[model samples]
Target: MEEGLENFVPLIKRSRGYEELEKDVIDSGICSGCGACAAFCDRVGLTEDGSVPASECNMTLGAVKCNIDGICYDCCPHVSYSWGGLEDEVFGARREDELLGQYLKAFAVRSKDKEVLKNAQDGGAATSLLLAAVNEGFSDAAVVTGRDDSWSVDSTASKDKKEITGGAGTKYARAPGILKLGENLRKIPRLAIVGTGCQIAGTRRLEKKFLSSVPKAELTLIGLFCYENFPYTRLKEIIEDRLGLKMEDVTKTDITKGKLHVWTKDGKKHEKAVKEFADLAPESCVICRDFTATFSDITCGSIGSDEGWTTVIVRSQRGMDLLNAAKEKGYIEISDKVDLEAVKKTGGFKGKKRAKVLSEREKEGKFVPDYS
Candidate 1:
């Protein structure tokens, strides 16, 4: 237990459980299946149809079900969050602009390493940072989202740069990097974790408790910018069946300037207007209000940078420190143009859309949507 946790009583097994989760989260279409529930419980898992639900084995006597007394509930990102509190913990203050979160610097950067740039989604900043952290012993490993054999997203932990780089690039589809993490996280005591908004939120929500559960583990979270995400199989179907492109022929995927582009190893490209695939985006993601992953140590994405460069948002001082150290070590190079307007334009747009959706939901009287 952590220092203050010694005074906290440990949970007994009786609590509101999967039944409540199904009603509030699963049915509500906000369950991202990040698997924090299952990471600690045997009875909960992601179902075949891509939903996270508690298994029948959770039932004990006729009506009683197994539970950890709302442990899973507290870990849920959709149920609760306070970015202000998280920023306070990390940086001792939050940014004045609610949309920008807290940050030390924003820049256009790319890896100086040719190998990383060749494989990364944009500038390779995220990959380069992780590579430096792991190889230089700043981290034991890193949890990352990468492609599985079926082209679906796979969440994994990697110690070596080879394994890390293999998972690079933009996987625009939904992969609960948090959920797919499974048991591998147990082996990583000190490390970095990268994921989308929801995943980062989950990590921050459960950071201390989750770390307490693990023996010596501590985490530095990296959040990827996300407007929305689609189901993996459905996205693959759109590419193969609808667009007449084979999945095997695809090597890269990117969403840029209102277009979806998939490129092959040979540099061939298949393109689709961004709106054409919008309806396939997850219902859970549709109401999401986060654009820059305001709660993470750092947020990186392709939105504000030129081709082959990434715009990095450093939230915590630690994030800036790691980035600077990596740059000094020749991991990456920085661009002179720091484009705040470009970032603000896109981030603000998403924030507005989020507010409109939540405002409508609040008026409908179901409940006020609070994804803080």
Candidate 2:
């Protein structure tokens, strides 16, 4: 037996393995691909697509059987759980603002660092905040999403300013960022994470489950506004085949004002309606309602801000403190001129869309998470 195998044997027997997760979540097509299930288990890992299982359940390979209360299933954001319960646990009350969820303040912010602004998407607020957190000793590292030359997204744990800056720009494709969290959680005591709604939700679930083992303050969540995410291959196909743009020549991509804009290295821009690629989005996104990353300490997006700024929604007191500290250190500039109604309109649309999707799934006898 391995050094720690005996201790995990008892827990493994009491926990549901990947088989149940496959049937209930993956097979049902509601898995968010957050990688929470595979993050904590050696037997479970994601396939090359960054979603779905890599192999069968190792625990059930022979005569071993898995039981209920598995960590994999329990930590999944797609599994049935009380959204209100999580809200209350995180914010001390259920959200009154159904659209934006719980928030203490909102701002139109931009980064003061020239390099960060140059490399980041929107105003570089997320990158600046992460830099401040690591520089000030609030966090030892940050797990962020970055892309390669071909726009393939992946997650990395950045421990320094240069590493964090490298992960500045956004990639429209989904990457399972929680895998990095699980890998570095034990080694890095203080960590920050930047992710979309589903990824943040999974992190919150992990935090709640391992609260005794890991303190709540150990992890900081900075959420990004995500309406939906596309598989990298499909998105690449759309760019290469449909838009007639080579992935190698594409410099940047942005979604704003209902349009998907792709910029090439030669300064040529290609544009298409955002809705044109709706069919390419993941099936799991249909059931997701977290447009503003409601569970995060701070949420950043381009929805309610100007062309060169990011809309910042501060949710927790810790988030506020961090933002203030960053501002004091001259990492970013904040303005109280956000278009709240604009943010609300986008979030409300997502919530309504999710409700309709869930209703349809319920009627079709498909598995749906307990939103109530």
Candidate 3:
């Protein structure tokens, strides 16, 4: 029993999802107490304090407490991404070249609620896809987005098998949990993961590796058109300073709203014009070019549809099957040929191409990474 396991017990208990626990443990100091504990857990826990003692121990700490195994960290609710082990071993295989093709896919799932429609950045495609997959038995669980205990407001994987599944709406932040997909691969055999282009790409890299050893049923990918990601620290400051809402006061964030819709603890709603805060997006996003997930099973965006309807690009067989099942079951409303030209007219894919070209050059040693 490491001294830090006690501290990690609280963190593990506090984490709401596997993704939340994985990404946060290292930074939260949960892994600092028992380094071997997390390593024993297979890097699922990043620090020494990340592991808790197992129950049945006769020794008393202070208050009532249960000792957890290092493996328990594997089941921790706080992980964010699946970056360790197999993922790190195959990092060299991930490249723009691998992102060139389309996998199974679907699109254009709109919510019946006008509020849900207006509240979503697209046509509520993300939420619809998860519900549809679960309903159709295509997946055992849907890992969606939600806020962290710290109010970081990142997406967390939802584990509910029924109607009460958790996860807030689409957050503007580029979610950090996408990396946790590989870790949850064992628990939730079939998963429907939602994210933007980069996240989809990163997950696909993981999916490819994981599938090589396991079955493809372990992971499914859904992509949203991402123009940018919000800076966390600055975004928090602005939310508190500009909106006059304390960080903890923020209950949830919505991307579908024409403006940024923020709900506070007091039930007061604050709306920030999306354009006004556009500059707050992360700088790394500017260098990213994948406006649409080139290799994702499905690609979604507002480019080709009305404000309330999502435009889904079904590029693969799996995507078509998922969408077909969703439509047949009446979970989603799909209308085709709504804005084929207009969707194509909304440009920015060039950024993806440019980013890919730069990455290629960097890998080839023609360009060096700029630490600054």
Candidate 4:
């Protein structure tokens, strides 16, 4: 066992199962829909609305009669855990930056590959890094979110460059990308995952639980900056009903500068203020304080860079190594022209929003996840 994990084993052995998860997180309306709970347990699945309890859990059904140590509850990101402990374990130090978390370097980067740039939402830096990791033997496979023809997103494990490229471009909806980790943990020794803040947190929790038996450095986490994400059904409705653009007709969708932009096959751009769709955001997002995926090795976003570049925040030596390898191999170009203030401003905005929401919830005596 990994050092310090022996102390955790007894606590994990006493952990409650899916029944408690449903009562605490799912029923409380704070489920982030990252699907970590259901990923490892076959009896537990996500409902149609993306909540848990799709089927009766084995523990709940008394099939196994095991009331404790359920991996489902233990792996949940929304469940109460020590944020500072996670920070110390992942980064070896607490973050000094109040908003952007710990980081070694930041850059505005773009992919050198023409095809990646053509298909990418912003700078294709994410795609470039994943390709570099696979080609350089940094990882054997990458888990990423991909969209169907109608722009509905799903998680996929891509083992090759061609498969990884299929996951290029951003989808504005939440996907259970961390579920791919649970599915492939035993099969793929070296793995990487690209996901949003909540998904990355769940992946970290999974790593803390299961990766002790394996080499921890074999897993890489690449996170994306996300202020909020919408459900696919509501997003589709807004596109079709509010914008009058059919899902199939829409070629691309992007959120930038506080506006949601949609481009159709006919080359017409339709847009609306992001706040106009505020009602569609899930409650889970309102309580989330992580805007830049602070727990990840690296975080990428389009917030603080030029129109065609991605802002990359390197938070660990692994992240820096992979980024430098990509740059050295001519997979990507890095520029030091990123606007640091812009990035912090956006992160501060998200932090303040989460604070306001938490205060309101506290006043109402609502359940708040123990992020501290």
Better of 1 and 2 by TM-score: 2
Ranking by lDDT: 4, 2, 1, 3
100-138, model 3: which lDDT tens digit per residue?
A: 333233334585545444445567766667777876878
In candidate 4, where is summed lDDT lowest over 10 consecutive residues?
A: 2-11
Model 1, runs deviating above 4 Å: 1-16, 56-67, 180-182, 212-215, 351-356, 363-368
Whole-structure CA lDDT of model 4: 0.80
- What TM-score does model 4 achieve against the real structure? 0.92
Q: Tens-digit lDDT track for model 1 on 27-77?
A: 767676666666656677775345776666464333334444455666676
Cα TM-score per model: 0.87, 0.91, 0.60, 0.92
Candidate 2: RMSD to truth = 3.5
lDDT for 312 in candidate 3 is 85
Best by TM-score: 4
lDDT accuracy of residue 146 in candidate 3: 66
User: What's the lDDT of the predicted structure labeled candidate 3?
Assistant: 0.52
Q: Tell me which of candidates 1 and 2 scores higher on lDDT.
A: 2
Model 1 poorest ten-residue lDDT run: 1-10
In model 4, the runs with Cα more than 4 Å from the true position are 1-11, 58-68
How many residue pairs clash in each candidate at the backbone level? Answer: 1, 0, 41, 0
